[model samples]
Target: MTAPLQGKIAYVTGGSRGIGRASAIAFAEAGADVAICHLDDEAEARTLVQAVTARGRRGFQMAADMGEVAQINAFTAAAEAALGPCDILLNNAGMNIRNPFGEITEAEFDRMVAVHLKGMFFMAQAVYPGMVARGGGRIINIASQLALKGSPGIVTYCAVKAGIIGFTRALAHEAGPRGVLVNAIAPGPVETDLTRARGPEWKARISASLPLGRIGQPEEISATAVLLAGPGGSFYTGACLSPNGGDVMH
Candidate 1:
């Protein structure tokens, strides 16, 4: 039972619940010290920290609104102070506004962009220098299946996610020569709080549409993140792994 990320350090945003929480636990369990940033979910974040510590990995928790650049900077500072230089950055903090294109407002569109694209940009920038100094690091951005194939109603979300994909590719090229690897994952619908709110009927339909005939679990997504962060995926860069259960076959 060798740990792939033994003694590594990872920072995950929106780590209080859903995919971020699962990825944090996976990283810690794989022998990496974990730092998590959450906006308003202190209790859950604390519990996750405890869980990481239980796995014999150091855990750091920070409260920051990732949508704000100032807050992102402060959070990155806190994370660095607590966890030391971040070697693995999981840009998992994201927001979605699902509504008809006609009903979407300017502010709504901006908010969606801010949380996903802007936040991801700043977080990646914050970690780049440290990663470069260490001679290498890994960055994994979380995108969505909708980014590849647009979905109705949430046009803004589709655009932002698409931007993430482009961003991941461009950043991967920029970071690769410096020994860093950047990749993205576009997960299909999962059985999480966000999907649960989409109603039981929609959930059933989505599951039926998938080749696997089932919705994905957070743990499954976390497993992929773990592999990408470890040496096993050192040669993988700018690769957008789609865990969509055959929804978007290329």
Candidate 2:
């Protein structure tokens, strides 16, 4: 049986761990070559590369800070050179600082925006032209459930995620006519390193509050990305798919 994404190339940011890592593996399992970027974890990134290659798919990895535009451009160029033009772009690189509204520092706010909103926007811009030239492609932005329903301590995080949704919608409108599909995934609380950093107590509270009574797994979210990038997702554009354990239902 032929895989859905055979012969395709995918670029994923923050692919060393968590959701990004799962998405990269999912793409590779679907028969796509992958190129990924991480902030500083060379060892973890190498492991991901190995995993992709183990699936009989080509893989490339680089150390990149998504907050920097020049670094993003450089990563894109290098990935394209190594794996071919990216057919699926996953803007999943991000970080968060949980602080109350009054306690939030300027630097923290800027960093969150830069990494999530700005990085996602320009990364899409960098790949969009090539996607257009290729006649079609998929761009998936990782948003959050907090973007739909505001959170108390992570104001900046919610703001930036909301911005991602807006960007996804507008980009989809502009790109859809040209055969490119742009969408966003708003995931709920997941058992990621970032969430785990919030401590077991916080995780317990969140899990109890969720409709599913537990935090989601990275592979669960990755499955959604696979759907969006594969042939099954041809008709979806400008859509926000939420796999939030029914945390915030619309």
For 22-108, candidate 1 gives per-residue lDDT tens digits of: 999999999999999998989999999999999999999988887899998888888888878899999999877878989999999
Model 1 misplaced stretches (Cα beyond 4 Å): none
Residue-wise C-alpha lDDT for candidate 2, range 1-250, written one tens digit per residue: 9999999999999999999999999999999999999999999999999999999999999998999999999999999899899899999999888899999999999999999988999899999999999899999999999999998988998999999999999999999999999999999999988888889999999999998899999999999999999999999999999999989989
lDDT of each: 0.92, 0.95
Q: Mark the regions of model 2 whose C-alpha exceeds 4 Å error after superposition.
A: none
Cα-based TM-score, every candidate:
0.98, 0.98
